[model samples]
Target: MKDPKRADFRGPLVDRRALLVAGLAPLAFPGPARAEPSPAPFPFGVACGDPTSDGFVIWTRLALDPLAADGLGGLSAPTTVRWEIAADEAFRHIVLTGEATALSDNAHAVKIEVQGLAAGRPWWYRFMALGHRSAVGRAATAPDAGAATESLKLVAASCSHWETGYFSAYRHMAASDADLTLLLGDYIYEYSYVGERAAGRPRRHDRAADVVDLAGYRNRYGLYKTDPDLQALHAARPCVVTWDDHEVENDYGGLLSQDVAEDPGFPARRQAAYQAFFEHMPIRRASLSDPWRLYRRLAWGDLARIHVLDGRQYRSPAACATATSRRGSVVGDDCLERLQPERSMLGLTQEDWLYQGLGGPSARWTIIAQDLLAASIRQKGRNGVVGHWTDGWDGYPATRDRLLSAIRNSPAQNPVLLGGDIHSFWTTDLKADFADPESATVATEFVTGSITADPPPYAPFAEMLPENPHVKYFESRAHGFMSIAMTPDRMLTDYRAISDRRDPRATVSTLRTFAVESGRAGAVAA
Candidate 1:
């Protein structure tokens, strides 16, 4: 249903201005004639991530003298990419410079992992290629070993549906002072439907309809990157990203497509999606694969260890047939009966790897950066029958239970699960026995809300939360990200909400603050 040959931009491409009342140029215009906007050296903007105390990765895409939308941009020959890191925004004290080649094979994107730097310091970076300059970006390194960090702040967010609304939440996040961003998943959706019913409104960009091939997926990512808010967010902070079901196809696993019988070439389609995903993301080369690598760990000295997991690639199929199932009925007796211990979300190899990482971690906090809700949530549906999203951790009950038990029994200190994907926000106390209301808490989970995606109305979910005892807080309406501050004694999370999505300059507000003490696994209102 999507036209691959079409240009990236749709509709009229022109900037309009309102005339000034005082017989002068509009307020949008400058006071006098100035130099033309320079062709950016790094047209795709700048990004920094995968930070360690010694060094961090700096990234930029070269697009000097870019050509028009025939998919031809810049020179076909490999270009020499150069970058510099400065102690100030003005580049007065340039400290590091490096040269890397941007090849045609990877769309001229340059990712340089600069090492040998001062730990726990802020740095500004920029790129140079083909006689143009990139927009300056800011990045920070982690604290050194045995350093007693007073606090560390990070923003966690996910589930951005571009067609539903603007990415105003990202704009707010870009302006914030968070050191890093943990993007949980649903970076892009892969379905096409006619009329307003598909997105519940008329679509903006049409190329995203049922992305199958590499180009289709690339174009979809390009469309999302074009959003100023999203670009600004990427340019500002170091982001640790992972994918959810929507990145490839909703509720898909391995070779299984959404409608397996209807689409037999799902394996090939998945490969294409994975390739495109690797190309656009700021992930390291080691993570690239024909299928894709899903698990990795990032360390921040003795303070924290972030364990990133891939939930969709090697996961089991959804347990229910209904479009929307409540907690109890979602994973019916038959489905629950079929959940074997061997049925894995992170395959055997990844499981072993995760356990090894967990065992070696002695940080103040072991944060699991994952895609779905780790806690069990049950709610009564309209038919007065209880249901659940069998697609989440609830589907693989045994595996979830094992993982919880591992955390409880492991040497890892203060395990906290950070997730996104349901679009709604939730805070829960993870326990070994969720069936028992007063069960001992083993861990804590904070499920951040979506960036722009519309969560289900608040009224229904609000009424349902009271019945679920483990759930500490739940909100279904707002669209924003979570700001988490971690310390030796406690971890504080602020649920920041955007005032509105329709407006570009929407202000962000802290909706709630919750904290989990060092020894306590449950979160208390801050």
Candidate 2:
């Protein structure tokens, strides 16, 4: 969450002048200093995401001096920009061209949601601002409505901790020809420590303790973008993203922080975090808001509908009374009580929208892209039985159960859930009650491990896997991502793991495969 508290580490600082300079760096520069312009914005390259049949959002940030330790360049003026979408890599024919403005107030970033395009078509685009050209990004429109499609593919990944490892998983994703990339949060971890910065790098802005202001948040993202592998992935294809706990504060809720003594100002902090997140991410203007509401639907023809959920914004507090508790049941009754039928992760209005949308669509697959596991997971510790991390969907059992019931009754062909946050891979049969060994599986879930965080070591949990028959697979010793394939008849998911997270050149391997057939919610080993 914030690098687990350590005495050696100092908190972030709050300075208005420093923040203003960092936020205004792009506008201060006049034009490309050289005759031959750079091919693209070096570190914070170009990308696209949240696509629909008619339109999609394009993204790029101006980084005149990315290596600046404070992550703040000296540009303070607004820059007029131009972009083009072409049919080929060589830009033989430019299909779409328009003007965009990058302002200091928004950290010199631009998100253009272009419309009036054909479905299921491949397109290439790039950006130009202050004489600088961004890398050419490749993106595709969604398939035609109700058209019979053979297959759809996507790369799923999460948790890219800068200190833990390199983003080799992104390299693998770039190699695969995926329709889109699904990022399940932890995009940036708010941490500051000695011996953690790379060689020749200076310490950037600190958060006083954790991310509280816009500059702290911006600096964190800047640090993450410095990774070449991540930049490669962004340059390669579009990505669909959702935030997890670490994006704001670990185990935070509406107005509560994990530490009682600390004043988190969660709602205000959440607002700032949301603003920073929108300014930096490749999200559509429609999805942008003051508090950044991220629940929405993405339709791929009539073959599938993806329901993306925001878990941290409206969730209840953790179940365990104290953060240091070792009790098996981390979810406390106080937390569970608020998860009544009316309580919502996407809020009441969004829940109704999802339910109505599901009933209207008859897709081959209905997938929920969420931040944490939806399936019930009960672990047996040395003392007794324990439930899931209080921060996950398991913390609100009632809400999860109701959602599952809705899926079961809906007309959707197959219901599947994709989750991240837990730094270990898991495949579970989403049953009404996992405690009952014979509970019927109502949906299938695939939980991808962190992209870089160390997995919880294989301990007694390894020996207890057999006791939980509903869990078909489990791996707690690797850091990587998941690759998923969807068809009319079956949904196939491969758990891809890296040889070693610590190794920058680690090779990725497919550790296991699971499939869910049409009309069936449970997963079977492949």
Candidate 3:
């Protein structure tokens, strides 16, 4: 029997007796850090992300009016912003301080990369500008590259639509004892309205139409950032983020738009969206030089190595895409075009880099974080034909095979894949050959559900489960996040479910728990 008191990540992995374990500390800031002033200079709050052993990037935008019509955060002239990092919540034990200029060119956002700090320790930070002080944010650096550590705790979430519901998942994450947070993708949606009942939405979007230019994209991000729960989540834990299709357009691939006729204008629009994303996110400043580059790796001592991937920027047009129809479609499994070896998902350069890293010196655990599901979900299509979704890995069979082969042949140990953008929870065994149900399982996969977005109809998806033996579990009727705790011996994953998205103070419970023992390539119910 499972111990109910120690079910959640906070209760078991983080001990209440001794809150601070080595460099990992619980979410405990001073009282002032929890409150944000209305219509204040830093209304959007503060964030820190992209952590390294030395230091991490800290961010804050001077937005007295975040929803301004011009998308400038209501700042006309450049302002100098000061930042400080301290060992304690108060500024008495200051370790580092610096000044940065927030200008209209970058939407009045100040992002600083602080170096020379102690590795693997917690730091408290805050900003000052426009005669007002921002909320104090808590951040932590990574453990040294190859150092041995006891365990790592992580929280993962994605697919947040502002008009659909509230962000209670982010609120709960802010109060947890997680060392790092992973935002897989779909951080913001382009459309002002999605699906039916647009007029009766729980919340209204900031724009009246779909976003097209830099101004529109910046405003969309501003609208999402202004949410109190999202702000609190950023202020609580450091996040590592990447983008999916909704950041540009629905189901778009590379330079192609949803419809082929709009391909002519897709380039300019994509460039604008990329620029806006960089300006608002807590990513490194070095990424601005080559905005298209996002795939990177981070090491968590000898316990784990996280390989973050970019799946949208360099993918080929969806297989069998037509000029008059959709960008991605459900095609029969017999479709020959999707099986072509030339159809690349991560493009050539990214594929080479990933293959090289997968074969490098081994870590105790290898975690691959990307934007979409890597497992096959074949189902019955119209006219009694088996089909696959062309927008995901099912469309590029050759690419998936090569990736699985590399993992099977590499020295990496206990590989596990993490994904989002499906708006549903899933646990599957990644087999060397998905076509053969009895084939060897090479790795395990866990795809998180949406934070607030609507899920696809559950009945239809549930009916197709028997055909997929590799899929261990599936659930589509909830809104929440995943809590993962990894040790050298085993990995424990909890599928946390929120009771209600419409409620501001919704309660979260563990809907299910699964465990994968060391050297095991499949998840078993715990």
**RMSD of each predicted structure:** 12.2, 11.1, 7.1
Q: What is the full ranking by lDDT, best candidate first?
A: 3, 1, 2
Off by over 4 Å in 2: 1-42, 67-72, 193-209, 287-291, 320-346, 380-385
Q: What is the clash count of model 3?
A: 0
Native-to-model Cα distance after best TM-score fit, residue 61 in candidate 3, in Å: 1.0
lDDT of 1 by residue, 123-204 (tens): 7777777666777788776877657777778999999887777888998888888889889999877665546555554236
lDDT of 2 by residue, 106-134 (tens): 77777887665666767787787766777
TM-score of 3: 0.91
| Model 3 Cα shift for residue 129 (angstroms) | 0.6
Q: Which stretches of candidate 3 lie over 4 Å from their true place?
A: 1-39, 194-196, 285-289, 381-385
C-alpha TM-score for every candidate: 0.86, 0.86, 0.91
- lDDT values, one for every candidate: 0.74, 0.72, 0.84
Score candidate 3 by lDDT. Answer: 0.84
